[model samples]
Target: MARMIVAEMCPQCGSLDVRATEPGWFRIEWDRRDALDGGWVEHLEFGCRDCGMTWD
Candidate 1:
């Protein structure tokens, strides 16, 4: 039997139906205005259509 190495999944419910949530102000919110800024955290939001769950 074949085994899955690393399957990306939703933490809420065990389902593969997952989609990436768009970032409205991705560039403006994430990008630093100048070089002086450092150690900024980034997020990748995901939404599950099956159970209507969202997480980052």
Candidate 2:
């Protein structure tokens, strides 16, 4: 199971006990054959149950 990192403010009630509802994503990057190969990037989106705020 993944761990949830709570935020400082609740989007809904604007409380301090903001809860993390979901885990976004995990990204891994590797070197290609050349420098022209763009590096890979990953993002994780977290949702707050209080105000339903999501960050990616």
Candidate 3:
């Protein structure tokens, strides 16, 4: 199943059109079960849909 993301108010424009974006290639999540191989892989980023503002 896919995850649902709630939009947040933009600090610069005050619009509830914020969305999470992935700018990097990937991210690692340290999990106990995956310790033998490596960490969980993931990616994430944040930005405002209306204003096109991005954050780290």
The local distance difference test score of each candidate is: 0.67, 0.50, 0.67
TM-score each candidate.
0.49, 0.29, 0.43
For model 2, the local distance difference test gives: 0.50
The candidate scoring highest on TM-score is 1
lDDT digits (tens) for residues 1-56 of candidate 3: 99997666778888788787656544455455376445433656668889988765
* Clashes by residue pair, model 3: none
Q: Can you tell me which runs of candidate 2 are displaced by over 4 Å?
A: 1-41
Q: Higher TM-score: candidate 2 or 3?
A: 3
Each model's number of backbone clashes?
0, 4, 0
Error of 3 at 40 (Å): 7.9
